[model samples]
Target: MRVLVYGSGQLAQMMYLAAAPLGVIVSAVDVSNETVVHPVSKEPTGVSLQNAIEDANAITVEFEHVPEHLLLDADKSGKLFPNVASILAGADRVREKALLSKHEIPNCPYLIITDVTDLDNVIASLGERVIFKASRDGYDGYGQWRMQSADQLEKLKSEFAKLDLVKVPLIAERMMQFDREISLVGARDSEGNVSCFSLAENLHFEGQLHVSVAPITDLSDSLQSQANEIFEKLATAMDYVGVLAVELFQCGEELLVNEIAPRVHNSGHWTQQGCDTSQFEQHIRAVLGLPLGAVDVRGVSAMVNIIGCTAFSRDLIGIAGAHLHWYGKEVRTKRKMGHINVVADSHSHLGNKLAQLLAFLPVEHFPELEAEANRLKNYTK
Candidate 1:
């Protein structure tokens, strides 16, 4: 079987790797040039976009920011899996909020702001400390501004005056002081069958994911059930037919939806080594209308993102339970260069191994962090 994937970043690369073993041919479109490139071989070929879609048995996306024209064209071809409606919901925060509300899925209270005038009422209603996000094309910390006080709002108004807020609009969300953030990566088949991986705890730095631990430590069965129910509700609402990731905020015993990712997600990267079926393969299977793979956890796992700086000792391989997957990308500030997965028989064992592995990472890249992490790891054990 052949599949066409939108976007040519690391997620596409990983999908290429996973599809290879299944004898599935995956090709990627640059989205900029509309150029077709073989996923595994990374060889550029001269196939037109129409022909590429015609030849492929299925189409999927690595990310949601695909151009609407291209998505519309693919929809006409009847090859787009998970559909344009689902993709749009993932791309726009307004649409996302509407979907959640329509399904009665719990999420942070939010308002759509088209004018600076609307901000005053929203602030008065929701209070101070709101997160302002661009409704479209925002990811990895860009296209967002935080308002902590009335002064910040005044400044933001000045900033928005320079840009066209009406055309793009923004989502203003009430800031919740949550105890932790967790995510569920689940797959749905055409028949509406769904399977979810264990909930994962995520740690973010400056709006970028830094680390993820799967089968979150001390996660209760009730919490897991709540997360699973939310995922199922979302999948059914969207008529989704592929891997979907739901990020959640846990406050006390309650969980609220933070956002939804229509494709495989960074939080699921630990599943590469920790699950019976990696998310990439499962997504491919779901899109191709194949039976979904098992979502069983193989062991407790931690995935640490290698952002930006490339210089690191190869001796990191010597650290027990360490496995590295590096994306061949030009080094730039804050780029996701690669990731390392560390696994152990139990969460405590995994925590200790991760602490040891952190010591081997260069101090320049991550400073004074290892000591605190080590202290916590030991204390928890």
Candidate 2:
């Protein structure tokens, strides 16, 4: 079977690798420029977008911000998973918030801002410390502004004055305290069957993900059940097919939805080595109307993102349980160049492996490696 994916990036490349084992052919569309390419090598497939969609048995996405026109084309084929409305919910923060509220799902208290004047009341209601995010095309820390105090509001307003706020409004979220960020990746088939991977503890640097440890340490049954129920609510609400990732905030024993990614997620990368069946494979199965793969965790796993620094030695593989997957892309600041997956029999052993692997990377670019290792090392059994 053939699958056409939107966005020819690292996520598409990983899906290509996973699909090969299942005898599936996956091609990617550079949604912005409307170019078709091989999901792995990224060479032009020399096929028209219309023809590509016509030939595919299923259409999925590596990211949600695909152009609406292409999505409409794929929808006509009746092969698109999760549908255009579901993707739109992820692309637009306003729609996303509405869905959460509609389902009675817990989320941070917030307001929508369509004009600079609206910001005044929102600030008065939500307070000074708030995060303003563009409703569309915002990711990896871009298209966002933070208000720390009243003085910053005018500056923010001026900066955003030229923006077409009416066309793409802002989602102003209250900056509330939480213990840490966690995420769950799950898959749902056309039949409404759902399967979820273990919750992952995530650490982000400057709004970008840096490290994720799966089957979270010190996990409670209640937390797992809560995450699973949240996933079920979302998937069933959208009649979502394929993988869906939910970023969440942990407040004591409660979990609040942070954002939804309607595709394979960076935080789920650990499944490549930690689980019996990876998220990529599971997504493929879900989109194709096949039985979902096992989401069983083989052991504790850590996935460290190789962001923007290409000089690190590839000899990290010398360390036991380290597996590297490098994206062949030009090195640029803040780019996700590749990732390394590390697995261990125990969290302490995982910590030791991480520290040992750290020797091969420059500390200046990877200071968190040791800190995370230390955290894991402190855990017993």
Candidate 3:
């Protein structure tokens, strides 16, 4: 079987690696050139984009930012996994909010702002601390603005009013104060069999994910049940097939959907080392109409992203249970270079390993590592 993925990025590279042993070929489309390209080697595959789409058994995406025309072209092929609408729901916040409401899934309370006038009432209702996000294209904290006080509303209105709101309207969500953030990744096969991975506790810095710990150390039955129920309603509602990631904010005992990713996601990266079958393989299986893989949490696992700085040691691999996945991309500021997966028989052991891993790196480049490692080591169930 052959699959085509849009956006030749690390996700596509990892998917290609995972699919190879499954007797499947995964190719990529360089959204920049809009042509078939090799995912790992980053070379031309000599397959025209048209022929690639025509020949593939399935088509998917590495990210949601692929141009609309490319998505429309693939949509016409009827081979797009998760479908065009589902992909659009992920790329556009307006569509995402509507989908959540249509399924009665809880999301942040807010209003749409298509005009400067719209912001006034939304601010009055939601509060001055609303976070305005571009509805069409925004991710990892880009295309986002924060309103700290009502005094700044006029300034924001004057500056933002000039924008072509019709082309990229804004979604204003109340800046929620939640206990902690958690993410749930799950897969739905073509036959609609759904399997959810463990709820992972995520730590982020400047809107980029830094670390993730799976099984949550203390995942309550209530939280698990609620998360699965939400995932089922969402996947079934969209007729979604393949891996879907839902990011949530836990408020007291309840969870509210923050956003949904329609493909395999960063927070689920621990599965590459922690689960019997990784999420990338499960995603391929789902789109190919195969049985879903077991998501049993193998052990206490932590995923630490190697962000921006590439100075970290490959000697990190010398540590027991440490698995490194290097993306082989040019290093740039705040870029996701790679990730380290560390597993242990228990959560405490995993935390200690994380601490030791941090010790081998420069503290200046990895300040966040210390706090998270200490939290994990001192964590209470």
Tens digit of per-residue lDDT, candidate 2, span 296-320: 8988999999988999888889888
lDDT of 1: 0.88
lDDT-based ranking: 2, 3, 1
The weakest ten consecutive residues by lDDT in model 3 span: 359-368
User: Candidate 1 regions off by >4 Å?
Assistant: 367-372, 379-381
Query: Candidate 2: misplaced stretches above 4 Å?
Result: none
lDDT, each prediction: 0.88, 0.92, 0.90
Q: Pairs clashing in candidate 3? A: none
TM-score of each: 0.96, 0.98, 0.98
Residue 26 displacement (Å), model 2: 0.6
- lDDT per residue for candidate 1 within 1-381, as digits (tens), equals 888999888898899899989999888999988889876455687887789899989999999999999999888988798899999999999899999999999999888989888888778877798998999988988999898887788888888777678888899999999998999999999999999999999888788898888888777999999999999999998999999999999998899999999999999999999999999999999999999998889878888888887888767878777899998888998899999888888776776787777656766565433643563376453
